[model samples]
Target: MIDLNNIEEVIKEEKKILRNKSKNYKENFFEIKNFIEKEILHIETLKKNGINIIPEINFKDLSPSLIEFKKEVKNRGCVVIRDVFDDNLIHQMNKDLESYIDENNYYEDQKKKSDIDKYFSDLKSGKPQIFGLYWSKTQVNIRQSNELNHVKKWLNKLWVNKHNNQTIFDPNNELVYADRVRRREPGDTTLGLSPHCDAGSVERWIDKGYQSVYENIFADNFIEYNPFNASYRNETQEIESAAVSHVFRTFQGWVALTEQGPGDGTLQLIPIAKSMAFILTRALMDDVDDNDLCGSKPARALSVNSTYHSLLLRGLVSIPKMNPGDTVWWHPDVVHAVEDQHLGKGYSNVVYVGSTPYCDKNLAYAKKQSKKFLEGKSPPDFAAEDYEVNYKNRAEISDLTPLGKKQLTL
Candidate 1:
């Protein structure tokens, strides 16, 4: 947490760096300020809505209301809600998956999909256990159950359209990616999520689109810069990939699957959203040169291959940990990387959720994705060789009912 006091120094250096690189510094610097302001507003809204990563959020056995959960996701731009679904049910699902694997040795997908090292490991040693939640009748039943559906409905409301606020499955629409969950173990540190913005670029001199949802910085003079403008996110399930398509991933989220406390394999965050974005963007730019347009970290003064390399010499970005049943959500543009769960007993399990997005430009991209799926190939938004999975279906939950929104909605 960079102290509000150090912000002045940061801004001073920001200007120096901006001037040193100095391209449209004036227009962009203030926009940087605007971005910070908007993020604060968004974080505040997240707090009021219930889940917060701020120092004040006390996740002590309390569960937030569904409406409040929806609001929290809208305001904070991300959250971790405790017991969004019954923990016991998740426990049962885990047991059933393990049993299914044991009974039939249901490892064909793993075998067929896996390769040399992985196959040798699986056949000789073993592969990581994968429960068929993607296909299991039990997993399907639970994910679609009324209680979970209520959560999904609110997700649809918070993520899609607040005006429609429709908490039921409109056959025409469904919650996106209603089937994404992962049970992270205590010592697993290789899940590989780099701290990068989803929308691709963060050129300050570009469009109105944000690199970080800094409401405090962006919404100057708006008595309130409304964070939950549902119109920007009105869609249900669709899309082949959330990456590359660049739909509004306003909030990145997760639902807790167990009791997580401090030092218990919790989720961590860089509390100051815009400041991190500003410094990181500048850090990358300042570290690069005219030739390295690709901007690889070529032996520079400012390179953080280690996630812990502090960006600011004088100030530290604050991070808050979350507990199981405790959800930790954040703005889409906010940079987040999983903390290594080095000191926990069981596992830190979660269902990752991000806001559903729908827009005309995104829709056209999705139809192309459907074509790729039909051809039994990777979706267009991804590289030809990327994310080639044997998973059965990738149909959009809606179109916005178009292709792009539909694919990513999942």
Candidate 2:
């Protein structure tokens, strides 16, 4: 971890680089400070209103004509696309997952295994709520489903490369990133994920590739900083760090397999993305140099707490109630967390199905993931342990659709 005391010098050094790059950088810095203050109020107001500002749209109704809907997603950096799959399909997937868990004795196996520490730290004082199995049949089917492929295509199109109007990827061609299935039972709060963004953390400032994504912020026109841009994100590679995500997922998503409401251990997010500008410019206001990038050397989750960002901490709101078959997706830069407690009646089941558009780095990850799929091993980005390798019902390459095979580089 970088010393919190050195944060002033660190910001000064980064500011020097920004000053040399843009002529009016200092002027923009002052402007960004004022903008941050206004944003603090705006975000607080939205937070007070709850998740009302977080847009909810039907997947089938998605189009350019929904100008307000598009604007909401662009501004907030997250959305709930209802009915991505049918209720029956959602119920079936849940059943399939339960079957797999029962057959493999997942709870028993997990309790016996000592190396299941990739995702969580301390399991809360009860039964495990999340399963790490990535290649389950239902997961594979959803990843390779034609309906989901279309949905991903639509999701990718939501982003536009505003820089030089240059297209950097094929939004229509889907790419797959296998992730875990979360099954949060009522009153279960084992996952200790705090308010944080998962993508690059401090790399947003250190890594030149990652820093390019925030060039507008450094230039002092942060209000125009479009998160949808495909500038440096296409090339940003992961450095040696803890909690690294290799794939540049445009949006992190989940397909709900069970009905869940706000208090049901569901997803929580701070809807505004422009507020991120404050994260960098905060040193100008605070006494502590806005220290603790919260995403320093040994990269960890980019955390948001009352000490550093009280507005954001208070602004974090739970997404609206959702039913099975609903899909919720958040921008890569959004600060999100799982509710610490589940005060609902039943389990909150969902599969992580993020979007990975076609890009050189992402394509490379897909190719590697394909190889891991063939070997019945965990993907390179995850822990190397392969508990599913000997499982009889694991999904294989043959089960993938034609497009799915293509996405996996098979």
Candidate 3:
């Protein structure tokens, strides 16, 4: 077992192990560099042609064009699926959520509490952008909606789940990974989030399971590294942290609850799908310190900045405008961030939802989360805010649809 107390020692030892496996680390570094350079050029060309780098597909066309959709998603690492839910339903949900917050005096409760979670403390905003509130009737209904579940299942299918004749995950059965919500007001002046990858930080370089997932890159064959291969992703363990997600999400996503577009605090992404190989290889080069993995640390999101990741930053592009009921999804390894300010005249709202498939690892998390849901407590992966315990109109067992019960493992 690796010692978390002696992280530097662990880092040094892990680097040596990876270098041995790679044999010719220098050659591997160059290969990844060349690949990233080509991808950057391609992204520039797309930009010059007035193309939006993030792929957008309407939900109505999903079934007939799945093959092509998969290709686009795999190539870009992110997509926006339009009209995934009925506009009227989404608008109502938004209204319901607003009532739930006001009736419970959520803003007043928040003001009295000090920051219990530091994940986004670095971000500057007039008020909290993310709310710890979960288990609202609106959130529960959205999670159980058949349309959302169907879309999540399709997103999960983008990953290769079978290897050596053994299935790694079930894409057909989507699971609920209860997360928080975001409500950014008009004229919001937030510094926004910097570029980063979630799920794990230094664990990606030190954990045995993560090493296996990136074995192709470590073995000096980065060109063959397939980010969608679910070979050992479920087996990877992150250091204990409130910011880290315990379940394996094939794609991190959010459903828009309002109309918002570029310059309105929307999301931005480095659209190249295979750029993760460049990130991994860059750390192995002679420039990075042996005891460091490009500023990664335990219990924090993996940060990507100009200091160490200037090349990948060149491809950063904001998502196109999104309407209520639209949703966006991105690969786990994709580097993404939010725009610094909301220049629009309305609130930008979204409910977090991820493409968490049915698997042993996720099932275990769901079982734990179900108990919390019943008690109106926060989910296992988040801070224990318990903000909804006695809140009015919080979803209860009677409120769940049959599909909701199954997804929540209730």
Candidate 4:
């Protein structure tokens, strides 16, 4: 068994194991460097031409067989789907969420606390942008909405779900991976999130399952690294932490409940799908210490910053203006951040909804999450705030639709 307390030793040992497994490691490093340099130049050119990097598709236009649309999504690593939900429903959800929090005295209760959850301790905001409350009726309704489910299945099909003649995940089937809601007030000056990849941090480098997922990159053939392939992802295990998710999400997404644009504390993404290769190979360079994986830590998200990833950072672009009922989705490996300031007049409200297909890992998590949903507690993957357990108007199992029940593995 791995000792969580002695993580430094584990880091050093994993680095050595990877180095030994690699053939012509130095040459491979140089090749990856060259590719990144070229990719940066290409990104710069696109910016010079005033190109909108994040693809936008109307919900009606989405189709599984649209080869060109699929190519664009594959190339950019992120997309914004418009009108995925009804405007009336979305507006009601926003009002319902506010009423739920206000009626339960959530903010008043929070003010008495000395500190926020450790996972979000680094964030700076006048008021909390992310709420710990999970079982709100608005959240449950949104998670089980037909429009969101349809969009999720379409997004999942973009991945190659079979490897070595073995089916790894069922794209047609989705599992509920409950996450939090965000409501950034107008003129909010939150420090906002930094560029990072979720799911796992150092585990991506140290875990055996993750290593297999990126075997081509480790073997000095990063050009063959296909980010869309869902081979060993379901088998990967992250260190147990409040910040780490135990299940694999093909895409991390959010539905915009308010009209949020570039300056409205919206999300920004590094729009290259294959940038994971640059991240993995860059850490193996001689300059970085053997025990370090480029600013990675056990319980934190995988960070991408100017020091270790200036090239990839250059490609960072904010999503275009999104209206209520619109949604944005990005590949799990994509690096994303939030705009530091909310200059817009409206509140930036969104509900986190990830595309978690049916798999052993995801199904197991869904089962646990279902229990939490029933008990009106936080999902197992998050901090145990349990703010909703005693709160009035929390959604119950009877409130769930048939589709929601299935997604929650009920």
Look at candidate 4 and give me any clashing residue pairs: none
lDDT of 3 at 343: 91
Worst 10 residues of 1 by lDDT: 116-125
Query: Candidate 2 — which residues are off by over 4 angstroms?
Result: 1-30, 33-51, 112-129, 162-166, 241-243, 283-297
- Model 1 has an lDDT value of 0.40
| Candidate 4 wrong stretches, greater than 4 Å | 112-116, 120-128
Which tens-of-lDDT digit does each residue in 40-88 have in candidate 2?
5776776576527678889789775777778878888888999989999
Best by TM-score: 3
Q: What would the per-residue lDDT of candidate 1 be over residues 26-48, giving only the tens digit for each residue? A: 44445554666666566556656
Q: Using Cα atoms with residue i matched to residue i, what is each candidate's TM-score against the true structure?
A: 0.53, 0.88, 0.96, 0.96
**In model 1, where do residues sit more than 4 Å from their true spots?**
1-76, 99-174, 178-180, 192-194, 199-246, 261-266, 273-326, 357-410
lDDT for position 58 in model 4: 93
lDDT of 4: 0.85
Report residue 267 deviation for candidate 4 (angstroms): 0.3
Best by lDDT: 3
Poorly placed runs, candidate 3 (over 4 Å): 121-128
What RMSD does each model have against the real structure? Answer: 10.9, 3.8, 1.7, 1.8
lDDT, candidate 4, at 33? 77
